[model samples]
Target: MAAGAPMGAGNSSRIYKGSGWKLLFPSWIIIGIFLLAPVLMMGVYSFLTKEFRGGVIWQFSLDAYDQFFFDRGLFGDEPPRLEWTYIGIFWRSIWQAGLATLACLLIGFPTAWFIATRDPKSRSTWLFLVTIPYWVNLLIRTVSMKFLIRDTGPLNEFLLSIGVIDAPLGLINTNFAVQLGLFYSYLPFMVLPIYAAVERYDFSLSEAAADLYAGRWTILRLVILPVVKPGIVAGCILVFVPSLGAFLAPDLLGGAKTFMIGSLIEEQFKGNAGNWPFGAAASMILLTIVMCVLLVYARNQNKVEAR
Candidate 1:
């Protein structure tokens, strides 16, 4: 009976281990269906020939990528010349996203630090206030922003009332308005991560540095920032990546006059262009850029861990 008991325990242990592996199957299936399958489909579509209206022809062609890198003119019979239109669009998107990220970092860092230093009972209230605006639909918030900043909007009226300016600010449909929209939309992403990091930091380090005759700037530069840098990077990535691919802000805020990468890709499929292969190619390129950014971050993180 003693030998039989050991055999039964071993059997049960094996059964438990088998069930654990079985539990992972659902997650694997979800990732395959939702993530990997779409990316693979896009990759294949990007290489395929484009149909006239809205589909792929399935035959292999480099025309989509060729069009992006080189312009063959309206007839496609002319000798190819370097394309600057798409390149300009990409540069504009990068510039907008970078500026938005910088704005968020400047505002968010101070706001996060203030929250972290608050009394424990008040911290939650402050966080709640920060997130409350996001509970409303994003489109609505964006439209409300439009109302506030337009030439005839309350902002201009208020300025006029105070004699701050002779005329309307003319903020609507401008790059500055788009930047404002992007900054408003993603500021929370910056603040929450930074707040979490600052909350975990030890103030004793600052005191110790001060005791050693370190100035306020020196302590902040050398001691505080290093410990909280991961959170700052995370916040920037969160803001910048989404801003790079954002279409709504550019569409509504910029009056659809300027095309960011997101707007350009969206227009290919949904607008009169009806070029599926080109859209897929653009998506693939955007995905590659995002992946490269993530890869660089991961490598830096690995180096930090190694040290």
Candidate 2:
């Protein structure tokens, strides 16, 4: 404990961090083993061809990526719709996730604006309201969606009792339901980031715009949106990334009518039972997709910040 004693490794570690150059062991180890390793493996896996027994043949082949992109099989009519099916699912996942992200943006932006602009006491209350669902389990939320929208459920019952339809309408197991489910589930994600941006904003900028003869719409369009874009980016990343991999919401809400990439990859793991190589390939494909989109987003962010 002597002040003059030689500092131990722990002390040196603390000293190095306190001086602001990090040498964090756990962080590096976690990233190396968990994040980087898996991604590298996936990239490798994506390039390899599937074998007869559900394992990779360990030869470098572009066949996996080729099949993924072209969605073609080894032969024909005898052909299962792998090519167009995979492409369709890929586009659908991206499209639906985009819709969900848009919905999240529309709903979350104004709410976050309201919450961020409130008085301190009111702000806390609103934030608490916004975040209360986090305490509820995610699976529970997705499952509960069915009852609310089902034929015998409240929505259909209400509609029918009031003669809104001749019969219980086919609301469940559709793209509309999937979109609603994902949007509702990820709404909190969009709100938190936008709220953070909104709260940190300089209100006087709006006032300045007003004094400069800019109207509310112009002020919002030119001044407000540009500044809060980082938050918009963050919100999109939060909502869209997870929505891409969300199998359960689509499965439960859409009742297996629509197949998401997540569900398809999941099938390789379990449904195709022992088709490990194909399953692994599918997983890798999904991982690559999520990574590519994020990389583009990150690059765009850097370009904006640099300017």
Candidate 3:
């Protein structure tokens, strides 16, 4: 009976371990097949030569990387002359994304504070309203913006009717339009995180600051900002990363004037210039930049937690 008891205990232990793995097996399969496989394929494609047609050639080459930094044989075959075109596109993407993030912060902070101060029932309602735009397709939303802002659109017609201007302001297909589109699209993302932080915040600190005769600005700077810093960071990251790779807004709103990295990558793949290898290289570069940003964010978070 004692020997049989020991065997039963071992079997139960084995079954427990097996069950644990069984729970994680599907997630592992999904990550391996969907995430890891595509990334691996992209890495391989980045190194291969691009065919003149549309796909990649099997031969490994560094031409794609070179294309980003140099104009081949431009200096009478001395060396590949430095070309800033692709680098400029990356920088433009960063600039636009950063601007969009800043705009989100500017708008989101006040909106979040307003929502956070509302009654619980109203808070949910306001958040629902904020997120309602997301239910509509992004492409559709951007196109709608085009209709509203274009020269012959409703905005111009209304202004013309009101005697605000002699001619319609050329608002569409401009940088301002792009920024507006990004801000409108990502505002909810920025607001929600900050609202969560505000809801969790202790108002006692603000009260204490007020009791000490601190100015409103001082109280906000010293007490409120620190408390909600994490939310701001989270919101910034959420807005910035996606904005960096924004294609639809830049393509539809900014037009030919704004050539961001996302549009540049799209051009390489689907546009008249179908260079798959270069596109893969550009994607990898963008991935590396995003990874670096995440690493920095993680390190900062760890430091804050440590303190």
Candidate 4:
């Protein structure tokens, strides 16, 4: 009877293990339908010839990439020169994203540390407060930002009322406004990850370093930063990647005076130009840049793990 019972349990276990493989089919199907298909479509479209208005021909052409890298005269007959316009746009996006990431880090670290060091009973409240702003729609928040910083908006008016400035700051429709928007938009992303890491940290290690007569800066530089680095990296990636492709802050806050990569790609497909292939090519290029950033991070992680 005991031997028979053991055999029955073992058979059931094997049956469960065999069925587990089937469960992943749904997840695989979703990824294939959603993620891989769109990327493949973009890749193919990038190589195809563009049609007159909003479509692509089956024939292959590199004119999309050529247009990106080279400029001919208003008439196509002029000799091609290296193009700086799109390159400048890309550089500007990168610069703006980097600045936003830096601003998030500078403010988020201390905010996270303060929250993580609080009493356990109050930690949830702080986190809740941090997240509450996000429950509102992002578009609404962005528009509200636009209203607040406009030359005659409440912020400038308050400054004027306080007699701090003779005139309105005129913050609207400038690069500074765009940076402020990005920082406000992504601050929580930076805070939450760093908070999670800090919450898990062992404070005893800092105490030990102090007992050994290590200075506060030294302990932080050698011990705390190393331990919480993964979270910082995660926060930076979360903030930087989205900022790189963001259109809303740039378009609304920046007054659409300059084109970021997101706005440029959007214009290609949706504006009067209606260049489908060019849009696809731009998307592919952006994807490649993002992939390169991720790959570099992965390589650094691998090296750290090996060490």
Candidate 5:
């Protein structure tokens, strides 16, 4: 009877483990099929030669990478010269994304603090209002911004009515317009993470700092920021990464004059100029940058967790 009992228990344990794997099998399959496969294919495509017609030739070549780094048209038939056009585009993307992230942080931190300081019953209501923008499609929101900021838009009408300016400001089709769209779209992402951190914070620390005669700025700089660093880091990552690859907002707001990497990539793939290989290479480069950011974020998180 004792031997039979041991066998039954072992069988039950095996069944439990098997069931756990069974539950996870579908997720693993979906990830491999949908996510991993596409990324791997893109990586493969990046190394291939582009067909003049509109597709990749599948012959391995580094022409796409060469064009990205070098290939000044000034060389003519000679060897490719170093041109910084693509590099400039990359820098512009980074700069725009950084500015948008900074704007979100500046605005979000205060907004988050406001929500966090609210009573528990009203906190949910305030958070809900913050998220109201998400209810509308991003495309719709961006388009609506165009209508509001155009020369003939309500914003100009209001300013003219108030006698603030003699002429209507050209708000659309400018970098400022693009930044505004990005800030408006991603503000919620920045706020939510910071709000989460603030909600979990100990206000007693700030009170103790105040008791020690620390000024408001000093307390905020020393006591509050350190504790909320993780959330800030998280919010920055969320805002910066998407803003870096932002497509719709830039396309709609910045116009043809302001060319971004996202627009460049779109042109290569779906636009009149269909060079899939070059597009794939550009995507890989962007992915590498994002991965670096993620690694840095992960390292910072680990350091915070250790402390």
Candidate 6:
């Protein structure tokens, strides 16, 4: 989501005056006109039929909804394929996104925990080191992962040298690569929220739990997790929703055999079978999913706060 706008115009030469909510008007206007307005327009577009004459005619029709449901557009082959293609792609994207979310959580949680355990003075240095990679372009990172995992790359060379395997492990252009890319791209998202929560946790609480005869595992399961649940949930939202619609990573790190909702929608806009309204509809579907996930996350976070 984008930032909201600022409010009312001010006098150029006036002394500093009292502040009020009016200062937010400009930001609100920008968001209303840009982001929210576009969403409302897309919602309308999703309901209309896709016209072949380069524009949708102004008529009340459920053709788009029916085609989306039954996989038969108005201008398709004579005998329509009577199955919902877009819906199939949607479920596949959701499955891959689930895998990506699990991958991010597994890798990111440990990293955040490690960072949280560091001294206050050292935390910034460690976080900077981790966050620095994110500063580079995402496309560059995807390409870089490919280079590192290539058949003749150092990783393969080192494995062969150590006799860990007779041949290099096939780790590129597969689901494994897609998972890796997702983890790498979104790990910081998982880490920062968790780090913020964990870093501020009272170390004394664990000590108290231990004094009460609670073992380390017991303290972690009982005390630590509950306090940091909000951060974990926030991180999950950050990683899960974006990975669910991820396009670049799948295209760059994996083979064409794997295509995500993002890449598929991208194809609708830019490919030989380009269809803008259909792409808009597909995008809105993913967006709807994202909004639902966010709502659930926010509710959970609020409950945690209440506790």
Number of clashing residue pairs in every model? 0, 2, 0, 0, 0, 12
Put down candidate 5 lDDT per residue, 209-288, tens digits, no spaces: 99999999999999999999878988998999999999888999988766788888888988446889899999999999
Compare the candidates by TM-score and give the number of the best one. 4
TM-score of each: 0.90, 0.83, 0.90, 0.91, 0.90, 0.83
Report the error of model 5 at residue 262, Å.
1.0
Better structure of 1 and 4 per TM-score: 4
lDDT of 3 by residue, 187-290 (tens): 98899999999999999999999999998999999999998999999999999999999998999999776878888888888955699999999999999999
Poorest lDDT segment (10 consecutive residues) of candidate 4? 1-10
Per-residue C-alpha lDDT of model 2 across residues 1-307, encoded as one tens digit per residue: 5566676676557554563336667788999999989877776766776765556677877766556656344563244344676778878888889999999999999999999999877898999998898798888988888889988999999999999797988789999999989998899999999999999999999999999999999999999999998998899899999999888889889865578977877766563254455556777777778889889988987887566
Better of 2 and 5 by lDDT: 5
Q: Which stretches of candidate 1 lie above 4 Å from their native place? A: 1-22, 255-257
Worst 10 residues of 6 by lDDT: 1-10
Please give the ranking of all candidate structures by TM-score, highest first, separated by commas: 4, 1, 3, 5, 2, 6
Cα-based RMSD of candidate 4: 6.1
Task: Tell me the lDDT of model 6 at 90.
Answer: 82
Model 6 has an lDDT value of 0.81
Candidate 4 residues lying further than 4 Å off, grouped into runs, are 1-21, 256-258
lDDT of candidates 1 onward, in order: 0.91, 0.83, 0.91, 0.90, 0.90, 0.81
Q: Which ten residues in a row have the lowest lDDT in candidate 5?
A: 1-10
At residue 166, candidate 3 shows an lDDT of: 91
Error of 4 at 283 (Å): 1.2
In model 1, the clashing pairs are none
lDDT of 5: 0.90
Clash count (model 1, backbone only): 0
lDDT of 4: 0.90
